[model samples]
Target: MVFWVPILSYAAVILLTAVAVLRAPAPRPPHLAANALLRYLNLFPVGLMGLWGALGHIVFPARSAAAIGWATSPFQTEVGAANLGIGLAGVVAAFYPNWGFRAGVAVVTAGFLGGAAITHVVEIAETGNLAAGNAGPILYTDVLTPLLLLILLALTYRSARGPAA
Candidate 1:
């Protein structure tokens, strides 16, 4: 349940948007799809999931740590704070809709999630921790979300730029 929430939400938003766009018309604008993807991707997966992580770590630290196969520590609070920052930034990026600002948000989100994915891998290797939160969908999302965001960002930039000169 814990590991699935973000994945499900992320997939739900993307799938829904894709369906809507596909069903729209024959000559859909390319940039519209890219822009919508960027907005929802940031809003749901990055923003809401970050907030959810903050809630789990800050409000339910013991459970969060247990799920990750770790002892509760003050560091969880720091992690929660970082989640809060990322969440806020993601939410703002969705609303602001500027390429440069969205790029910065994507970079920061990638940094945080990419770092978390690396730490999760190290923890799994060092301690053989296979807890759901440590070695499940959470880890995959941590790694893949950033990559997807970058890809979408590139597509959006290209579409916005128009034809080659």
Candidate 2:
């Protein structure tokens, strides 16, 4: 039950990361190829994360909520919808990858993940939720992935700076 969430989350992250790494754009030329890699790395995994967070809860509201030890309620539905929206934003940003779109997605995702991490910590402190879905290894991702996203965003800016900066 609880274990499923961690397994699913890790699997999703790994699968998406692999896609980002392996299916990197090969649209000719060396430097453009680098930008392609950067774009894919920035977009796909985070989009997948958004999707993973979104799909189950929105569609299977009860089971999704129960998996995280929450009541099957409207709150879960709302959260699921939010996730779906964020995920769709990620998808749009992935395709666009302009400064405005990419930066917006990155910032929104970071804020969301930060909030999630805080909730996990608060849950641990207030109610002792140690479920794999809640306080398991996946919890670290709620903290780490956002930071990595910011770094990836920075890489975009760095690459934009033409390597001297």
Tell me the TM-score of each prediction against the true structure: 0.90, 0.73
Question: Residue pairs in steric clash, candidate 2?
Answer: none
lDDT of 2 by residue, 1-165 (tens): 445544555565556655655665666334443445435534444566667777777888777666666678877777777788777887777678575677777788789878988998898899988767678755776777677667766656755656595
lDDT of 1 by residue, 89-142 (tens): 889988898888889999999999999999999999999999989998899889
Could you give the C-alpha RMSD of every candidate to the true structure, in order shown?
A: 1.9, 4.2
TM-score of 2: 0.73
Lowest lDDT 10-mer window, candidate 1?
156-165
